[model samples]
Target: MEEMLTEAACRLGVRGAQVAVLVGGELREAATGIANAELGTPMDARTLMQIGSTTKLHTAVLVMSLVDEGLLDLDEPVVRHLPELRLSDQAATASVTARHLLSMTSGIDNGFYDDPADYLATLSRMEMLFAPGDGYSYSNASTVVSGALVARLTGLSWDEALRRRVFEPLGLRDCTTLWDELPYHRVAVGHAPDGSVVRPWTFSRASGPAGSTLCSTAGDLARFGELFVRGGAGVLSAEACAAMHVPQVSLPTRRFAREWCLGPYRRDFGGTAVFGHSGTNYGGSSTLLWAPSTGVVVGVVCNTPHAGYPLAAEVAAEVLGAAPYDVEPVTRLTADAEPYVGRYAACDLRYEVSAVDGVLTVTLEEVASGRVSPPVALLPLERDRFLPERDLSGGRGWDLAFVVRQGRAVRLVSGGFAARRMA
Candidate 1:
């Protein structure tokens, strides 16, 4: 395991990595490389690394606990708990429910706000990408709202609720929603692609519920994963636990993921059903995968962005005796893509489509950063449906589907978000 970890870290040019694998009711851990590249600190089992969006799982469990206690309803409109909830779309603001937030189908525009209050305030000024629960769009604001709901219903802060409800019950002593809350010495420093250190180790507190902040050791995360395998042993009812694993929305274009459940992303690994979550912050990446049939849970953390996926994949293959199933190949069709060539905008994201030498290509731009990603060639899968040659960031499947109206592309849908064509 250590050899595999070392190889993966080296291959990805990561400074360090830590992994925990649970099998046959026994937990095994391995660590390799430096926790702090400058200080030459070694990463170990106790090293705390940011788990990123994986924190969503913890938040989901907290909500489930409330549901178990009859304090919350999954289908209740969020405004019922926080009547002040306001959005640019008043109807969506009133109609959005807890179930939509948990399932990432709220259709609220995604943004990173400094605090939960700020998120809600900004949401109130933004229009919905789609009607509430009309489509799947991963929104950090939605999770922040969910966390706020938890706070309101439990009479506790999101952090406090997590501590009292999740960390304490699951015995995750080394986990925390805030970076500063962790002991400085035990925390693993994050590093950029160039190996430079990243400051402000955590995202803003407002993003905590949506997976912006949460630092924990691999071992601590494995213990949390065990809860799912054990069917909610102490914290959640079996029914609630089952609900967390059940598929809530289909995500066909996502690489390995088949659906988004209450919290975790669901996928199939070598014919065995596996559910888990992956998280990435500025300079670090982490993943937690568990298969109930085999009782195997794998948790991996790396101090470099995008390094955890390959490492976690290797670990999963070793434990499951087979790799993740291959993504279905997109069948290219013979169709003219000229009508689809145009610029599309949605919230902070922009899409530029063009055709050159009879080949169609698409590039996504971040409006705020003015950063345009490299153009990816799009192959026609149907008249208006296409698939990117490669996967987009955020595990969004390579599939790109267009909504055409009056012989012009109206919207480009991919990565669970829709970008309307700019006139």
Candidate 2:
């Protein structure tokens, strides 16, 4: 495992990494490379790493908690909770729901590029590409709205709500929403790939719901995963936990590394469906995935900005596979996977595929030169498989699959991979 972490970091060009794997309620910790690669500080268990979008799982739990309390409805409109969110277009404002925001179909583009101040208003001003709940485009603005809704429902700050409802009950003392307020004596400063200490940006407290105000060690996160594995640890009821894992929408990469149930958890790992969240913040990456079937929870945190959340996924994939359980491979055919074999025009490349050895191997051709080169081969595994060819050193794979529609494969999913099987 130590060698695996070192190799992963080196492949990602990351200077340092820390990974924690939970198996059957026991955790195994490993650190490789350096935390401050130039300063000679080694990555360790206590290193304070960021868990970016993984925060969504936390917020989702909070949302479900509110549902358990009858304070919010998963199907309710956002305007019912946050009337202040007036979009530039009134029609969109009228139709968008809390579900729209939670599921990332709010029609707002990723808003991180805009100044934090303008985030909400800018999102409001943007025209809806499709009606709410009609399609999916991941937007931080949606999660931010979720944070705001939680605050409004509880009449407390997001940080306070999370602490009183989650951290305190879970005994996650190391976790806090206020990263800027963290005591510098114990916290490790974040670094870029080149080893320069990154200037900490003030995460928009208003937008923090989407990606802000959370910090903790792998140990603390493991405990949080345990709570969910234990059906919300009396914080929420068993029924509610089950509801959280219910499929709220059909997503492309819905099941990667694990299945995308309602909340951030995957269903049926080694036959156990664990419920938990995965997060990545600027300059940090994290993953807290567990398998209830085996009672194992893995929580990983890495401090390097570019270490990326995919590292957590790499860890999860490895951990789950290593568990001592039998996963009966479901035999599904790839015969319908032929149509996806044509050219996909992206910004700069043409994606093409050809059948190889009864499987699909993808090739990204540089369009200008028409030079074809091999990419990681994506094989069919009961209708889906991981990107067998990504530069796994940084740890991100789409785990793509061929979506069969109308008795034929029609689309290739992102995060979850799919390609047309061409002759």
* Best TM-score among the predictions, by candidate number: 1
Clashing pairs in 1: 253-397
Across 157-184, the per-residue lDDT of candidate 2 in tens digits comes to 7778888998888787666678655775
Measured over all alpha carbons after superposition, the RMSD of each candidate to the real structure, in angstroms, is 2.7, 6.4
What lDDT does candidate 1 reach at residue 58? 86
Residue ranges of candidate 2 with Cα displaced over 4 Å: 1-13, 22-28, 88-91, 105-107, 193-206, 253-259, 265-276, 322-395, 399-423
Worst 10-residue lDDT window for candidate 2 reads 323-332
Model 1 scores worst on lDDT over the 10 consecutive residues at 326-335
Per-candidate TM-score against the hidden true structure: 0.91, 0.72
lDDT for residue 5 in candidate 1, whole number 0-100? 82
